[model samples]
Target: MNKLRLLVDSVWRLTWESREAAHCEELFVPFNPWRESDLCMPSLAGYLENAEPGSSFKLNLSPGKYLPQYQTDKKYEFALESFASGTRPPHVGRFYPKYLLMGYFGNPTPFRCIDRQGGKFTADFNHPLAGRFLTLEVMVREIKQKRDEKGGECLDWLDILTSGPGIEARYQGLPTDFFEDDPFHREDEGDDRAFFAQPRLVSHVDTQAQAIMAALYSRLLKPGLAVLDLMSSWQSHLPHGLELGSLVGLGMNAAELQHNPQLTSHLIHDLNTDPDLPFADGQFDAVICNLSVEYLVRPFEVFAEAARVLRPGGLFIHTFSHRWFPPKVVKIWTELHEFERIGLVLEYFLRSGAFGNLKTFSSRGWPRPRADRYYPRMRFADPVYAVWGEKLA
Candidate 1:
């Protein structure tokens, strides 16, 4: 299996495995129409309502009531177009029957449609798993007591990293709430192609930050080795003295990539659209993502791809500063503070499970004046952060 699929399956299993089980039972439910208010009941809600406390039941909902059908003479094209354009159609809220049907069936069901005479169309919204026997093993873990609330001191990224798994374990799961839903989850979703069509020669960070990044690259990267500059633009910021056998630039803009003097070759591809990298396994000695980590919607997948493309023991260096297109940045990056941001990146590396010897480094620019200090010697500066790890077998 591919790495991405394997990772997803592993996560799915882990989620179920980690649950606490107290009681379990089997049940078979039939789908039947009731009063308008009763129709809103969830498939499992009816079974749970009558069950005893601290008990769980496995439900096998009947399928005859959730059969797929065709909707003819419907203007589905416009609706689909609006959805693709990151907007909900005006009539979507009014389509209660369709939603009700889908609730009994399933979401993201198989949809087959055909264009017909005139502006009308024929569409099928059938749940892919409909009519199939499903076994749901439910578990009930009762909470008898609540832990006392205590306001412990907030630990920064440095503290968490140094304290080991005790702290880091808290960030292991998927951070779904840390991002926007659907269309917004896709960073740079709309008009991004047009926004990056032309070459805009500009440096994203200050010269000090660039220097720190270049120095890190020089220290970690070797001479005459294949490297990948992911999400690259016109400038790669590689140290002038360092030379690489091959420097491949993968980004969204063709013109900007072509203008990059360091790139031996370049490919135009949006990582958000597809996290899979277009390269043979273990092709690169190192991979670098500079000043663009905030824009990734699926960072874990991209990190896994980086590991796949890197040779065993190869390096993956990701660097970023407090500079980004706000609209394109993910919610997590904008909502969280700098220290938490580092923790988030650390979570990305840990979740990928393809790296070892992880390390983090930060550089602070010009210090703030003494009067601005909230604490003694705690001065504010333009900070640049780098998190790197070695590819593991």
Candidate 2:
């Protein structure tokens, strides 16, 4: 019997939202294509039979293979106790446990909440991937012989990737209500300058996650583009040896920006204090904000300013993970589903009206580097989420 290890990249869609990419890597996959028809889907076995270490291939899973295409029904709608902020009620386009809505054992599957009225909240029981076409890019991490031909569980990588409340879902079937209280409000109403006064030279995400973010930047950032690293800290996660025309860091802490090795020049400017960028229009080819977008109180103003600074065809990219300081992040950000957070950022681009070709990405289930401090506690690396679009000119 053969055993395989794979990282599955699933490109899924939601109406009007950009395509969502989810990457899941598995340590062990039993490979008896004929006997394990249930391993992935029937269509996946053919690819596994020939897969090998370091090989990657893409395939399309027919619609309805996930759950069924979304169906219109009454069971989805339910009433809410109240819309109070303290109660933490469910809102539209987020997910909740199946049991939470129905009052019984949910078996751990998450259901998308599609709507919330004055008193009721509707839950979409359909798999978030339902009706959405699934395009998978599989990379065979390792393939080896199972020393013994013994029975084992058929761990579906797709389920592991998309399962539980971990996955983010559709932006909204209808207009989503933010909340009764202000979402832009943060736990600490103190001036941001005061909060960021001290230079915290620590990595927000783990080292492996940092490498992934830099890899992402390397792909989107052309070699000679003038890139702006907005709200940057001590370290700009640009690839080690990239040649750029100029790298500018704009942030609150002067010392932090000054310490970033990637920045050609750095400025201590708080977008919260002054939403406008201090640059001529069309000056930069691209702008990037990393791990710090959630803290922006004036995101719309900042986005408009970013667009104004970018050249006609320039790109604006924002990458973030699930970590944030509770007292500093915008209140709504804390409430967003990890994927819905992508939609939240995507909205920033759409509202700009200056960008197109928008897309979102999420990578999960990668092995955490053993060297990282959290490696002992967390199984996989911290999931990385990014949203980006290019200016229309």
Candidate 3:
């Protein structure tokens, strides 16, 4: 037999499963309930007391709906009750996939459901397989004599690419305080437009990073397709030979944008102030943000807007280097190690929930013959990192 537990608020739902049948019931425990908790649950101590090291079992559950008392004004209160009750409504039909509720902030919980009218309602919080009568399988791997270390060690760039925690996991690992710092808060928290009004016609990255970026654009971007060069300046750094149907630039400095030879049209907008892109839905084939991602106060929101403007299957690419305006960069960027910056970008893409088929590329190890002569003592060339994702078709 295998034992498992399902916790909702302060209550515990325990199950005992055998080859023949599985039995489950609720065991209310007296304790203060938390508003939100980590998704990973605690292990069952009762089952492990006598279990062998190699013992294992499997658990399977099906999808169903739960109906609970609901009032728009009392959403949180009812949501908590629904979670504790685990009540289900009777509906005779084929089993379907679990219904995802639209309302309620934070991560998705089973306590609430959204109706067609966009009204929030409390729902039964039964496990998806409650009505299907599916068998529960459990497996006991190893019962460690000593507790394992909690929290994972930060990974290097190469290790992150090869063996990933992936985008979603990395996003979840970030602390709430990680994004709350005011490193970019200026004494003159006045208009950002005034700060960027003067055009600085200098490239942020070295020649090697620029070349790598142009090369990447040449390979990934095709000719005669609409493109949005985000946070652009006097030069898009697109490949010299590449042609595009339309190239639109969005930047802060009007003078810089007017000087850009490749851009057919341009708009002066500060992303830090207004993260929303001034474009229709699916307006571009591709969107590229070059060497400027670190400056955004709300990168996840900006990435989401990028996804909204891209056509189905359109690409959004963000390339950055070690170079940045320290005063404008987010606090998290300044605190994290160089390699961990890549993970942070990955999290931005994943947190947006607006793109698919995410990937990362690096030009960290590339040779820089020109840079070597200019800065001989420099241990490495301008390290370029890019993370991209495609809009879901």
Candidate 4:
């Protein structure tokens, strides 16, 4: 069954486990001792033993007022007494999805129900689902194999250790800077590691700027081309219905890449430190870097790397917007005016000596009112521009 159902079912069974099991009575004093004589106790301890802890844990025995006494170290005893009371009051327990059940396989560590409110409730010191009984709503079974007297290495593990060869090596001439320079860079060697280690999964552009990006992508990208998504994140946001042979994502965060449904294969690498891509020469038909050029301190090396990996006649297109984290964006990007910034990017592509035809596109800012209707005092700015080039043979 799904993990959510497993968690919820565990909590449901706890109400019965605490009441019927003889063990729970051993822990706490029951409020209504007289009722125990009329009930049948069942073996629910085994069920509780396997129950996964829920996201929120609370005991509402007999659905009355909240009992603050259960908040103490003697909570197990209180829970047992409440269970025996069998009042079955409106109850609430920590059983929800989107929770991490933290525990070890062989330990007596406390199981905690952590909620969004930032409160961690430690339960009966047993598994949170320990005081419950379970009914199997569904059963899962797999085919079993009959075994012979002698057991040899399993075929799966053996095959993993003896997989066949993949692509053969062919030497493509490396760029001059490939062997001469180091591309891997760290902003500050002595400062907090978080400065560069953390991945900020956010859009680099505003909504209007994103529309501009999508428009540029739509115009430049076509069907049946192998595309490289450079500096990708949790979202690629490529224009819809564009059929491409391949879409390879290259980024820094593995978790981000793993969940990106659009990527065929993702490589986790920090380009600032090493511009050398883990790809072959002329491997992609097109390369797209969206809203990331401002962050590149070593733009020349990265641009060259992009050109090296792109096939002849392939396109290297990058779009930029007005927004950027000031500190993180290189000084050059932060200080430049619009025309200068475009020229700067254009120079990077031209200087790389790997691109053939270079071009630029600029989308003026949000539509302005007619000059005669304008208010006396205001200046607005265009927020986006894109520069691109074709890889040379």
C-alpha lDDT score of every prediction, in listed order: 0.55, 0.70, 0.56, 0.49
**Per-candidate clash tally:** 0, 0, 14, 15
Q: What value does the lDDT take at residue 358 in candidate 1?
A: 72
Q: Model 4: C-alpha RMSD to truth?
A: 27.7
How well is each residue in 1-393 modelled by candidate 3, as lDDT tens digits? 312122111223323321212223222221111211221112323333444545643333332212122233433213322221343321111111123222433433222122212222333343222323333323344443423323333322212121211111121133212344453453345577877888898877677768778987898899998999999999898998688999999999999999999999999889988999999999999999888887787777898899899999999988887888765666667654453466567667767778777766554543355545546666345766677878987
TM-score of every candidate relative to the true structure:
0.52, 0.84, 0.54, 0.47
Question: Which pairs, if any, clash in model 1?
Answer: none
Over 260-309, each residue of candidate 4 has an lDDT whose tens digit, in order, gives: 77788888777777878889999999998877787776788999999889
What RMSD value applies to candidate 1? 18.8
Q: Which of candidates 1 and 3 reaches a greater TM-score?
A: 3
- The predicted structure with the larger TM-score, 1 or 4, is 1
RMSD of each: 18.8, 4.2, 17.7, 27.7
Q: List the residue pairs that clash in candidate 2.
A: none
Q: If the candidates were sorted by their TM-score against the true structure, best first, what order would they fall in?
A: 2, 3, 1, 4
The TM-score, computed over Cα atoms with residue i paired to residue i, of candidate 1 is 0.52
Model 3 C-alpha lDDT versus the unseen true structure: 0.56
Top model number, lDDT: 2
**1-393 per-residue lDDT for model 2 (tens digits):** 333333322222212222432323222233454345466665566667666567766666556765566566723666685222346678666665665544645455566666667888766677665655556565665555544445555555656555432244334333345544687898898988899999888889888789888888888887888988899888888899999999999888888887788899988888887998999999999999999999998888999999999998898988898889989999889876676677678767776778887766676666678988887798678888888888886
